[model samples]
Target: MPVVWSAVGAVVFPNVGGWLGGLITVRNIKPWYESLVLPKWRPPNSAFGPVWTVLYSSMGYASYLVWRDGGGFDGPARLPLILYGTQLILNWAWTPIFFGAHNLALSLADIGLLWINVAACGYSFYHINHTAGLIMLPYLAWLTLASALNYCVYRDNSTKIKEVKKDE
Candidate 1:
């Protein structure tokens, strides 16, 4: 039972950061986001919740495995943990920027950094524990798709003086 709880905690903790961010400002997101020209490849709105749930669970399990392996304090394993923490922070920041503050440009920048950090983490994880690293691969791939989507949103919505002038 204790192990089960710990496993559950492992999946939930890292994801809570994003969940909290989204919950805080979910109401403000639709106005700005709905007006944008999203890429055709954008997944259905229904896809995000379930996908993230699974991804975060895998991430948490990976964290638990790394921590339990006695590699948390020091080892090559520590590198991925550190990278994971960094990326998680960046991940949480994106929702507030895109949704709460309505700064899609900043969100795009954050997502770009998140993409890089995930890559770094993935590489580090591979060298430490292959399974732990493999667990993160889906997350990396999803983020890659997300980053492209974010880039498109930013490019399409950027405030151009020419467009403003034309509107006037």
Candidate 2:
């Protein structure tokens, strides 16, 4: 039972990070998001729930595998796992900036960093466990698409924060 609980925690931790990010934006974001000119290829709003659900699951499982293989909190394998935590934190920051605060430019910047950290995590995980890194490839691909989407939204929507402040 204890091992099962541990596995459950491993699988849920990453999704919890994402959920926390969404919770931060739960109220203030809709109007700004609805105003954007998204690409024709963008999925319907409904698609995001399911897509993120699966993606988060994959992320959680990969994280679990890394932790299981890499040893406990203070093990020699801690380096890759530490990068994993960093990437997750960056990932968690994107939604609130993009949705809650309606800062598309900031969101773009955050996503850009998210992309880099994810790649770094992937590479580090590859050295730790090849399959664990492979599991994150889809996540990297999705973030690539999301970063492009974020950039497009920023270009089509918000003025530079500096410009807005000057006008104010």
The best candidate in terms of TM-score:
2
Per-candidate TM equals 0.86, 0.87
Off by over 4 Å in 1: 1-3, 160-168
For candidate 1, write residues 1-168 as lDDT tens digits.
987797788888977886787585557657656766778889987687778878888988887777666357576467778888898889888888877766767898899999899888877777776787899999999998888888887787776523654797
**Where does candidate 1 clash, by residue pair?**
none
Kindly list the per-residue Cα lDDT of model 2 for residues 15-53, writing each as its tens digit: 887677666655644754565677777767766766777
Q: Give the TM-score of candidate 1.
A: 0.86
Local distance difference test, candidate 2: 0.77
Task: State which candidate has the highest lDDT.
Answer: 1
Candidate 2 — worst ten consecutive residues by lDDT sum?
25-34
Superposed on all Cα atoms, model 1 deviates from the true structure by an RMSD in Å of: 2.9
